[model samples]
Structure formats: C-alpha cells, structure tokens
Target: EDQVTQSPEALRLQEGESSSLNCSYTVSGLRGLFWYRQDPGKGPEFLFTLYSAGEEKEKERLKATLTKKESFLHITAPKPEDSATYLCAVQAGGDSGYSTLTFGKGTMLLVSP
Candidate 1:
C-alpha cells in the first residue's frame, strides 16, 4: 500500500523565519508528488507537482523539491499570511490506467508576526 508521512504535526515560526516541511512517501510506483496549501475551512490549493527526482517548482515564498522517496516544501521568510496547513500527496501507477492519491496528515504552520 502507498503511504505518506509528514513530520512535525505543527510548526510555529516567527514572521521572518524560514523553514522546510518534510513529506516522506512510499509507493510501489511513483507517478507524481503533489504539494498543497489549505486554509482553515477551505479546500486545499494546489502548489506544485513534481514528476521525477531532482525536479523542483516554486511560487512566491514556497519551493518544492522531489526525490525518489520524499519531497520537501521550503518556505523562505514566511509571514502571517503564509500560515496554513501544508498537505502532501502521492500518485501511484496502477494497472487500471488510473491513479489515486494517498495523502499525509499534513503540517499545520503558524507564522506569527
């Protein structure tokens, strides 16, 4: 079975502090790794999709990197607006010609100004 684990269930950071969130995953065959940011009471917003090892994507203050077994979301100089629940999910290849996502519990980031 595919599985995902996100470290540090919650993180507290100062307004200008920088940090990285880890997403470790295990799958029989990896199709893609996805990153998302979700605010309370709202659905998750798409951040990035990494298809291969060494691939990376960035938007504003967030950067995502993927490896064979894990992915990382790097937040540089965060602000209170950046406080959100960061989610990680993995798509696994299957014989049915479809893919399904297995998600982690997510990391709740709270940035205080």
Candidate 2:
C-alpha cells in the first residue's frame, strides 16, 4: 500500500518566519512526488513535481525537495498571504490504466502579521 504522512499538522508563525513541513511516504514502484497548496474550500494548486531522489523545485517563497523516503516543503520568510494548507502526494503503480495520487492530510499554516 502507498501511504503519506505529514507532520506538524498545524503551524502558527509571525510574519518573516521560516519553517519546513515534512512528508514521509511508502510506495511501490515510485513514480512521482507532488506538492500543492490549497486554500480553505478550494482545490489544490500544483507547486512542484519531483520524479527522483535529490530532485527539487521552487517557486516564490516555497521550495520542495525529495529523497528516497520523504519530501520536504520549505517556506522562507513567509508572510500572511503565504498562509495555507500545504499538501504532499505520491504517485505509485496502480492496479490498471493510470496511477493516482496518495495524498497526505496536509499541514496547515497560519502566518500572522
């Protein structure tokens, strides 16, 4: 079975604070690791796609890095506008056709001014 676990389920930070969220997983025939940011009552917006160990991607204030068994989402100098739920998902082999993402619950962040 494929599984993902995210730590520090909820975080509270002041403006200019920096922190990193963790996502650990177990998958068979690992295909891809994806990171997304989702707002309350909204769908997730893609952030990065990592296909192999040591892969990384970054955008704005967020950086995502992948390893053999886990992935990390690093947030730098976050502002209130950057507060959101960060999600990590992994794609592994499926029973048929196309594979699907096994997503972690998510890490909710609140940045205060």
Candidate 3:
C-alpha cells in the first residue's frame, strides 16, 4: 500500500531554534515527493518538489530532501512567523501517465517568540 506518515504530529520551537521533521512513506512507485506549508484558513503553499532519492531543495529557512522510503524537512533558525502546518504529499506514478497525490496528516509547528 502507498501511504505517508509524518512524525511528532506537532512541534514547538523557540525563535532561532532549529529542528528536522520527518515524513515516512510506502508506495509501489514514486513519481515525486512534495512539501507544503498551510496557514490557517488557507490552502497549502508549495515548498519543494523532490524528484528522486538524494535530491534536495531549500527556501528561506527551510530545506526538503527525499529518499527511497521517506522525505525530510529541515528548519534552520526558525522564527515565530514560521509557524504553520507542514504537509508531505506523494505522487504515485502508475501506468496512467499521470499521478495523484496522497497526503500526510501534516505537522503543526508553533514557534514562540
């Protein structure tokens, strides 16, 4: 079965604190792994697209990486404004030539000032 699981469910960090979040997945075939940030009352904001194992992408204070079985989002010197729900989604590549996303529950982050 293809599925995604994110750990820690929720995280609390102080301003300037750094941490790494994990996303575990199981799938028959992987097309891509995606990372997103969702703010309250809004849709998820795209963060990164990892095409294969060992590939990584980064933004302001975030970095995302992928492997054969899982992906990771690393936060560096986080700020209060960085607080949000981090989501992990997977695109399954079957014979259809296209794919659909299977999303994880998400990791809610709280950064205290």
Clashing residue pair totals per candidate (backbone < 3 A)? 0, 0, 0
- Give the per-residue lDDT of model 1 (tens digit) for 1-113: 88999987999999999999999999888999999899999999999999999999999999999989899999999999999999999999977858988999999999999
Per-candidate TM-score against the hidden true structure: 0.97, 0.96, 0.96
Query: Over the stretch 76-107, how does candidate 3's per-residue lDDT look in tens digits?
Result: 99999999999999998867767999999999
Question: What TM-score would you give candidate 3 relative to the actual structure?
Answer: 0.96
Candidate that would win on lDDT: 1
Error of 1 at 61 (Å): 0.6
Name the best candidate (by TM-score).
1
Judged by whole-model lDDT over C-alpha atoms, candidate 1 comes out at 0.95
